[model samples]
Target chain A: MLRALSVIVICGTAAMASSQSNPPNETRSSPATVVPQQQTPTKSTAIIGLDGVKEKTAGTLNVKDGKLCFVHSRNKSQISAAAIADVVTGEDSQRVIRGTLGTLSMFAPYESGRAISMLRSKIDILTIQYRDDDGGLHGVIFTMPVGAAEPIKQELITQGAHTTIQTAAVAARGKQ
Target chain B: MTNFFRITMCSCLFAMLSLAGPHLHAQRKDTEKIKASALKVEMIQSDQIAVPAAFQVAVYENLIQQLGKKASFLHVYRDGDRDAASIPNLVVLHTTVSRFKEGSEEMRQVTTVAGATSITIHCRFTSADGKLLLEKDVNGKVRFFGDNRKATYDFAKRASAVVSDKFSANGQS
Candidate 1:
């Protein structure tokens, strides 16, 4: 359903971009495709959040009856099509270290503090780029269970998306 | 279908569609935007704290990350960018860590199933004209998992919640 809106937006923005002399500065940071005038709610258990931050709650990202909804904590955001310039998604890993250290301490692999420092990692991250009604470019990212997010991710990409994978940070962690 | 039934059905559908929109009734929404709050968030600064550089870096990066997550601003820049501040109608943010607790994760694992780590941030939102729009002490705490930097994430959310409430003319918070 979100992808449906993206297609509409892309068609609209393409038309507008041709007639206009200068595109709004906001759309320049990332790919800004013209998007739907409305959105509806979607269903599925995936972590969702806004801009470059993903909240803890896991749910679907969709537009329900014209309202942009990310279920789980039931966060509903209102952004008009005119407010948005594009929608893009990508993978992000914001690592954390609490769990890895607690267990690693038992084995005494190395120094406890160093082990903890090396282990921190982000489980999942879903990044999005958008423009608001005022044409201010913005982004929101989410993280979800890798197993379950395939469908949701594919749908958004097929609808019109630019995808990038974060470089593996494990090497850096190992070096540390 | 009977003519009366068909007509009645069409009218009902039309009523539902019209009811769904204010524009359909010719009621124009108040689109007037408050210019003062329509700011491009440029620089975010925080007072130096006597904490681990790693923790401070986490907090700083998280705050910038959270602010960038909002799809409202035309642009959001990091601290080192000197040129962003020169833009018109720029909004600058200042934060200070008034209270901090470097919780021991080892103590947490040994003591109980959950541990407490937290940080309190006093955030100030100011415009180019030197007007203070929001000043709030936001708290971030992580109990079971993650590290003290989790406190930074919580603080970022809490601070953004406060700032967005007052900053967006559309009430984006």
Candidate 2:
């Protein structure tokens, strides 16, 4: 009886040890799962610069062949670097859309009729500010919508005549 | 004899468990990594040198509609000649934000994420002689949706509204 009991104990110990050691096939499959994840690229390469701006893990910024490039989080489309002509910075800084003066005039008038009359008479500079997706800003030059170029020029000249383009950061700080 | 057999079996089982444990952990880590990678933003643009006029018109129209009353005025000039004009209280600038249809596959394949996502234009408004005026970067994110053109438009619209408010207040100065 003593010998039989001893054998039974040994068998139980061996069974417990086996059960604890093997774990599950799923567990063994972890390495395979990990390898692929490690290989996947997370973000696109894009560069962005601005004040009070923090880098999010969504996309990336980079310069390719002297052109700035940014990849979106989802579809990963390829765009020409030249599409971005320039980057403007400041509080109210904006990206100027490349379009005709007529199109831009449609959205924002150069000034009141009086201002227009002056613009038509002489060269009147109209400044338009815009922003891009990367939180950068830009400005563009155009004529006043109204016909008065001279008076508008005079007014601008009196008002320092030069458009004070402020970076979005500076504009935001109310410095411009 | 039985004792020896039991000890050997226990050791082998323990070794197997140890190996499997790390593999499972590593798998979980890998999955987490992939999920993290998929959550980033990218920038992209068109390859064509000259964008079509129709496309440009559409973009301009879309921008005007979005700006509504904020656009003080809008004017389109073809090759430095005035083509169209409008008076809006505000203006907004935007950049194309796009996402890859196949996630980051393009980036992985070409290793050249080229215009996958980015800010292409630096919009600025200045005096005729290039005097600094007002400017901002039209930056945004791309999501899993239709073409990114709409996304860009939407961004422009929202940004324009914000800029209009600021301009109106500052114009008093």
Candidate whose lDDT is highest: 1
Which tens-of-lDDT digit does each residue in B45-160 have in candidate 2?
33343332222322443444455444443332222112112322222232342222212211221232332332233344333333444555554323432223344455556655
Tell me each candidate's RMSD, in Å, in order: 24.7, 33.1
Model 1 Cα shift for residue B164 (angstroms) = 2.5
Q: Write the per-residue lDDT of candidate 1 for residues B1-173, one digit (tens) a residue.
A: 69999999999999988787876434433333223333434322335655543345456556666766752453565443555556765676676777777775534533435458878777776776778766788888877555455777888777666555555544332
lDDT of residue A104 for candidate 1: 62
lDDT of 2 at B35: 7
lDDT of 2 at A65: 41
Q: Model 1, A35: alpha-carbon shift in Å?
A: 57
Residue-wise C-alpha lDDT for candidate 1, range A93-166, written one tens digit per residue: 23233346545654443233322333322232344444544433344444443322333333354344434421
Residue A57, candidate 1: alpha-carbon lDDT? 44
Across A1-176, the per-residue lDDT of candidate 2 in tens digits comes to 65565565545544544444343343233211221111122232121121122222235333334232234544332223333332221111111222264234333322221111111111122322233444333233222212222222222223322333333433444554
Candidate lDDT scores, in order, read 0.49, 0.33
